[model samples]
Target: MSEKEQPRLASGLAQKVVDTIAPTIDRHVNIMNAHGIIIASSDAARIGTLHEGSVEAIRRNQIIRVAQADDTAGTQPGVNLPLILNERLCGAVGVTGAPHEVEPLADLIALTVQLLFTQEREHSRSARRAAEARDIISALLAGHVAADVIERTLDAHGLRAPLQLELWLPRSEQDPLLEQPALDGARTCWVGLFGAHWRLRKASDEPAADAPNANDRYLIGPAAEDAGELLAQAEAMRTLAGRPAMLPRRELEGIWNQDIAVAVARTPARSLKYLAARAQVLNQEQARTLLVVAAASSMSEAAESLHIHRNTLVQRLERIGQVTGADIRQAAESLRLQHAVYARIALDELQVF
Candidate 1:
């Protein structure tokens, strides 16, 4: 079989074995590929040379002992043991010492190398499965891949159709999910997005309610039926976050009172800019006062919400109108100002301004 088709010792892996074992054992360690070429050795100069002892060990599928230096071509006084993985001989590991002195060490080294190879194989398999999941999710979200084709691919990978999409956008660029995938167990597959965003595709067999607990660093998007809808939910959440008239105080907010604000945010860029222009001039204090007034049922409630006296709130309202040229007292102007504030916030969050 071709080397790729058969289990063989990779040069990097062989080198890692040598490096790891060399420190613990005082004797030199060497790892040779199936062809008996030294791939890794504690003696750096000996690498890439032939080791006849290792070659004999592999050919006989057993250990071979060299009694003295130069007893075999490119070999020293040592013991060489064949490294077997899955009952197949893949390589040999040799330890440099008297034949009887290093025989036990060579055996231990062979066992360690075999175990490490098995572990590496498992890791490679898991990575391959995760990559398959990512591809399936990408195709599913594209919404043009044929259903049967998706189903066949899912079966091939032992994955089910994704039931829901979960998204997370970092509060800052330094979030860890940008560099590593979140460990949500085996059933969920994660895909990373361009803006340090991450989305999870939970297989239909997994429980839908098992989401990560709320945290300060990430703004979680509402769960949706697919990635596309999940992304839309994320966009809506961002728009709501940007609204000066609304405070995103809750971890998950319903879309009940947010339809108009979302629609206004999706409007043409020029219209959004025009609406945002008036509200953008308002400073932080003015914006906070406006938010309370728009959310409260009455001016007294707005004052209480702001923790200020009603007369003090009236003064702030007057200042706000002067800055924005829009009255907050009248219902029509209040509604217009709310939309304008939403547009303004969305623009800044999206960096579209």
Candidate 2:
């Protein structure tokens, strides 16, 4: 709708707005839907009639409107103008004058529509984001869910992963950086555990805010390879917990043995947690402790599997005993620690199962 149709329109407003804007340009204004149904027009005949074929600009919400020099845009030499609200496209305005006349009007119309749509779109989008954010938190915080299922749920909501994951822990939600040009280059996701957030993209696309509290790992990949790769990454994510951090294709490959990859596929629910927590743990020492707990109910065998010399393993065992108050020398204690680490594969959430 035009500004003239606003709820609190001024007296003599419709005619006045038409008079003021029409003279400022040389083309007639036409407002149409995607189906070419003309809702309103400055030209009398076009008011109730359709534009013959589809009105593509309306469908795309694009500002610039065009037609061939001879196409049915009425007597215009060629249609060139814009349908806009305040520097944004809201509706189309066509100019019959030369390029000089048409060009400026196109820009002005785009500008006008942009302004008109800005507040409305933003308000609507904000409410939508708030609602979706609640849902995202629900996904992360509530219930027992399989890894593939959570991944699929995210996909259903348009979040796909193995997204080039990165953690962003912001000091404040009110940061000005959120609206900067740089933020326009990625998608965001949040994790409250580490106070982290992430930015994702397939290739390079405009950065969008995270769907909500579901942050920390952003998926950036080539668009076409996204789904399958995300699944593989999810499996990797499951297996890599407690390992030293390595970017993909680093020393990390050999570290992820075939068995670990298999373990990842089999352990869906724990996978996301494990990988995320693994990244957070960040050092071989901590990881080794977790792995030692994982390998055996006996510290002696855990040490053997880890290939550490027995005395050194004893010292390491002592360190873990000091930290967890559980003697790895005891099978029950060792087993409990192992289960805790393994169960916490995706540590960002509370996993009872």
Winning candidate number (lDDT): 1
Cα RMSD (Å) between model 1 and the true structure?
Answer: 7.3
Which 10-residue span in candidate 2 carries the lowest summed lDDT?
244-253
Tens digit of lDDT per residue, candidate 2, span 296-351? 66667766667787788777767677766767567676555554443343342322
lDDT for each of the candidates? 0.65, 0.44
Q: Which whole-number lDDT from 0 to 100 does residue 190 have in model 2?
A: 35
Distance (Å) between predicted and true CA of 286, model 1? Answer: 13
Worst 10 residues of 1 by lDDT: 247-256
Q: State the lDDT of candidate 1 residue by residue for 1-353, as single tens digits.
A: 22346787778888888888888888899999898999999989988989878889999988888786773355578888998876788789889889888899888888878888888976786587567657765665555676667656655554433434444444556654444533433343456543333344444454445444343223344344444454455556444444433323234232113665567756777787887776777775676577667667788987876689999999999988898888777888877776666676656632211
lDDT for 160 in candidate 1 is: 38
Model 1 ranges off by over 4 Å:
1-6, 19-28, 42-52, 59-77, 85-88, 111-159, 172-192, 203-262, 273-341, 344-353
Estimate the TM-score for candidate 1.
Answer: 0.56
List TM-scores for all candidates, in order.
0.56, 0.32
